[model samples]
Target: MKKLSNTVLATACCYSSLVAAQTTNLNEILVTASRTAQSVDETLASVTLITRKDIERSQAITVADILQKTPGVMITNRGGIGKSSSIFLRGTSSKNSLIVIDGIRVGSATLGQVSVEELNLSQIERIEIVRGPRSSLYGSDAAGGVIQIFTRRGAGRLTPSFTISAGSDGTSLAEVGLQGGDQNRWFNVTASGITTDGFDAKTTGNIDDDGYHNQGLHLRLGQRFDGGHELEGFFSITDSESEYDDFSSDRSDTLTKVMGASGTFAVSDMWLVNVSAGRSWNKTKAFSGSAFKSRHETVRDSFTIQNDLLISDDNQLIFGLDYINDQIDTNNAYVVTDRNNWAGFAQYQLTLGKSDLQFSARVDDNEQFGSYTTGGIAWGIPLNNNLKLVTSYGTAFKAPSFNDLYYPSDAYGGGNADLVPEESDTFELSLRGKYQDVNWQASLYQTTFKDMIAWAPSPTVLYPYRWLPSNINSARIRGLELSADYQWQQWLLSGNLSFLDPEVRSGANKGNRLARRADRILNLNLDRNFGALTLGATLHAEGRRYTSDSNTSSLEGFGTVDLRATYQLAPAWQVRAKLSNLLDKQYQTISGYNQAGSTALFTLAYQPQ
Candidate 1:
């Protein structure tokens, strides 16, 4: 099956190659790839930008819905809205990739995973995904890549917007916001709420309606002074409650909050300096019936100081310092609850004779894990006016999460303090280009990991057969990615394909496929615009997957389709509708979990012109 899918994708790529409908311009100013702004086509990396227009066009309720399959990304959900979800970027573990929001890292300290499901699209302005090792630019948890989310910002004259919607499964949504900006200052404030009586999440053993509710706010203000100086500040929060089936509890309540401020100053014509600080909080409380079960909370404080300098007409340099502190507050006592990490990084960019080159390095020192260094190099050569060739190599590592090192001993298992961090090396090459209205890319890459952490039995006096986390695995992964975007007349065609081979290199399960990593993923989007009305469709397919290292249990391959439409009533009013899972497919990406059957939603909006 995998071979057949690969062959089909290869044939499609040779037919013209692709990325997406809105990406052919090559004019996007990307900031996540190199920690500095550059045109998307000029960066020597695999990157995707999802704009506000794209978000509204998709009519997606959750953030993960917008990132299902874009090159090297794969998403799995335990169930529906507000359920636990995982994003396997580059076929790496959930904890291997990093998630950033408005310059602040937000996630559970214990699990080291981001809750992408809880992130709705109403307050989001855009999303940027960089697929490759980014530890050289950001300190930790960037072995696979980095995903950055930017919230709504003010621009132009004062404007007000609101949206109300209803959907299947008793789902509902409401949002309101006011935004405005001039040359000197800007401000934006938004509030949103959503609720859904979801479907049963477990295939068997437990039959119940799992429901979820969430409310959130986003507030931002920014000021620009003379001499190319600026300052910005933002605050955002989400509170949610969800129901699911579990042995210890059946309900989960969570609160996620973030606040931050940043400033940019130009000291000289050739140099610029920036400063920023932020705090994020994540807390989860479990409940069954009316009885409270447990609680886990995480707080993160971060600060940064960076300087950008233009050495000459063809050369630029960037250097920065970062400070991060993670502290935990939980019901269960552990050995240690807090840790700090200090990092310094430098990057150099050169544009010489139509060729681009970038070099980056970073050093991080953690309170518990001592120090580590990583580096990367990238080059882009223009083969002609219509094509370009790019190559890159990088190294990255992931530190153990709090649960892996400090969880107290229990009856079945416990944490291990004497564990080493996992390390990885990646090499990539690609051919990318644009021709008039068509943009396409074909990329191939491989990554090798050492000292990967895993759970295994370790005999001891107190707990003879306790399973504890240890650095006991290694893996080798190879992948191919094909993406393309084309716009012709009134129709837009865009899509991407992901092929992954994540293998366990050294373990009792050696030669087995990496647990839960699917080998083939295909996504496509087709849209047509007719006057004031627009119509579109999305198709997503994935290959089979295993549930554990032993590969005994497996889940079959599946596919889904979504249909959407939008009609413009006026310049300031519009209506939208989406029929999700249009095929009414019954499939599960996660073992033993049940997926939502079908859902439909209709929305009306009052947006500013």
Candidate 2:
């Protein structure tokens, strides 16, 4: 076997593979990029799809690990696995993206983020990541993009599967699942547990060993009637406990629950109606040794109704109404505990000759911020047999969280109730093509923000300045992304690169890069198959990033490699092994935080073929 440099491998592999199409085509269908089903190549937005086979092959334990390999995406983890993780998309803030599970929003409204670190990959069937603003369809918290996770459902005949794995750091994992379905009915159930005595999170601080444990359960059911009516429902829950070093040997317990039900009916030949309702709950409690310190909980309930109408063979329209209520519960007192929002949206899609056009608009009414409107337009033009051009313009906004509006006002810096919503306008242009067995996409984008929120010293205070949340900043973000994949007879190669410039345009911190956002990122993966054995390797490289707005503290760039192998023991069983951080590279995504060292895992899986 011979090894080649990333640049050389990418170029040579892509050029050589452009001879013919393979017997197996993996053209994926996506729904998160738009609210409708469309092939990946036909969607106008930058998107990435992770399927079940990819997950099993990579042997990723959490959703964060999978997302780190995607283009135009960055993650900042406070420590090792199961720690607090922040996601940055296309130079946008951590809270600017929306997360959905089975068509239902799931996250903490008070923090304006989701616990992607806690999401078990064993229960997920697919994940769709759409980059760029999407508020015209999702309403709020979509200034960056949207990530939707689809749980595993029943398919084909009855099947049972199980997996067991153990590795370094006292880590162990076990999972079992059963799925079955007929033409009219289907059901799936899964259970998983993972535990690890992780490494110290702080490099130079306390010597206590932080550890994490989690247990998860998931269930899905669906039914189909004779009159073009279908019903589906799902429920998933995860409970976890993690220890970390702060002021003391502190620990926290986290519980997350998501449940939803949906129905689709064909009202007529040209009209189809869909209705859904769901709820998500996120709760956490902190403890110092034997004493309970504090607790916080957020609950969100949502309802939606949509209608799709076909005007002609080339024209289609979709209209929908959405309602959401967010409530917070905490041991400490606060001024406000709940809020509500209602929205109405419509979209029109048209296909003319070699052009595809889509127009969308939304109107949202919030209890605290009154009414706001947003809109977007996207166009795709086919330039030749294998090339296409896409362009889009859209506007988005983010509402302030509960803690940002109603914190205590006594000794600490008080919250500001008059804060307006953060807003942005974005424009993007992309080129996509498929030549022989090589597929590639390149995109350029820019976004301008207004009324961005930040915690800064109050200007009115004279001596002792109090830091308060205020709309005191604006930003300008621009970036370029390129991704390519090539598949040959028994080998597959893929790579992606990103360049970003995220600046605070109008503020005291002007000309400074955003915190924890790297200016350059590159990722590459290569895999080969021989008989019953498969081998894979991955490389990840990231550039330097600042830790604060002043650029005083920084993290140096680093690169790491990973290796994996899988062998088919029999028709119904398989064995797999993975080595992470093969070079044992020492680096940090956040200042003072320690990452994992070299680790290995061996897994055995059983499934009926």
Candidate 3:
């Protein structure tokens, strides 16, 4: 079955490639790749930019839903909307990627993964995704890449908006927001709520329906002074409750909060300074029937200061310092509960003739693991009038999480404080071109990993039969990515394809495919606009993947199609409808987990004219 699907996809790609070969140009501005605003074509790394208009046109309800269609990205969920989810980038593990919310790192210290499922798309204005190693500019946990989300910002005159939606399975949504700003001052506030009586999450065992509820709030305020100084404050929070089927518990509640303040000053004509501080908090509680099971909480406090200097018309330099403190509180006993880390980094950019070069280095000092250094260099060459070639080499690392070193010895397993961080080196080459009405990019990359951490039986004589976390494996990952877009008059088409080979290089599981990472993925979208009405369709597909490192179980490949349409009812009102999983295909990304089937939603929105 998978082979047949692959053949069909290949044929489609060939047809689309011929149609998209004609020439086109796209000029998008992004910031996550270099920490500075620049044109997408000028950056040395592969990137994707999602704007507010794109979000609205897609009618996506969550961040994960929007990212699932992006190149070099794959998302896996255990169940419906508010369930546990994981994202893999370029064949790297979820923890290898960094998640930044308004320039602040947000994740759990113990699990070492971000809860992107809880993030509200209604409060986000833009998202920038950089697909490559980035530990040189950032401190750690960037072996895969970086994803930065920007909250809603006010612009121009005052505007107020609201949206109401109702759909299948007792699903409903409501959102309201107000944004306004002048030349010197700006503010934005938004609140939203979602509820759904979803399908069962498990295949067998429990047949009862599960339900989820979520609420989110976002606020932002900023002011610019006359002396080239600016100040800003922002806050975001999400509260959710979900019910699922488990041996001990069937319910859980989670609360996530993030807040920060920042200031920017222009000290001189050639120098600029920026400083910021922020905090992220996550709390979860589990229950078994009517009795309490357990509770866990993680909090992170972070600070950053940076300086940018213009040395010459074609040369620029940037330096920064970062500090982070992580604390964990839980009902289970552990060896340690807190830690701190600090780092300093510098970057240089230079341009000469038709070539651009970038270099960056960083040094990190952790309270538990002394010091480590990482760096990278990249070069971009203009091959012709409309074609360019870019290559880069970089080193990245992932720090050991608290659960890897501090978990108490028990029947399940014990943490090993002697465990070291995982490190990797990557080399990449890419070609980008633009021809009349089409734009395209292709990239090839390879990564070698060392000191990879895993949980297995202890080798020491002291605990021979017990399972413990250790550095027991190594891996080599290679992949190819191709993406293209073509626009003509009122019609636009875009698509992406990725092929990955993620394998354990040396271990008992050597030569085996990594768990939950698919070898092939494809995405396609087409949209057309006529007068005040628009229509769009999307197709997403992935190949079979293993469910465990041993490759004992697997899930079959599947594809899904979605349709959307929007019509303007008045100057200040609009209506939208979406039909997901139109074929009602039955498939699962995980061995025992259940995925949502056919669903539909309709929304009405109002805006002041």
lDDT of each: 0.85, 0.84, 0.84
Q: What shift in Å separates residue 190 of candidate 1 from its native position after superposition? A: 0.6
Candidate 2 lDDT tens digits, 541-574: 9999998766778899999899999999999899
lDDT of 1 by residue, 1-609 (tens): 001112222222211111233544575666788876665777888998988888889998989888884778888898888899999998987788888887777788887778888876788887889999999999789989999888888877999999999999999999999999886788889999999999998886578889999999999888877776778899999999999986567998999999999887777667777788999899999998889988999998999998877676568788999999999999998788999999999999887778888899999998888899999999999999889999999999899988888887776677888888899999999999887888999999998999887665566897675778878568888999999999898899999998899888886889998878888999999999998999999999998888776788888889999999999999999999999998899999887788888789999999986
**Each prediction's TM-score versus the true structure:** 0.94, 0.93, 0.93
**What TM value does model 1 have?**
0.94
lDDT score at residue 26, model 3, on the 0-100 scale = 44
Write model 3 residue lDDT over 102-205, tens digit each, in one string.
88889989878798788889889878899999999887889899998888877668999999999988899999999898867888899999999989988877
The lowest-lDDT stretch of 10 consecutive residues in candidate 2 is: 1-10
Which candidate number would show the highest TM-score if scored against the true structure? 1
Which residue pairs in candidate 2 have backbone atoms (N, alpha carbon, C) closer than 3 angstroms, thus clashing? none
Q: Give the total clashing residue pairs for model 1.
A: 8
Write out the backbone clash pairs for model 3.
23-435, 23-436, 23-437, 23-438, 24-435, 24-436, 24-437, 24-438
Displacement of residue 523 (Cα, Å) in model 1 is 0.5
Summed over model 2, clashes come to 0
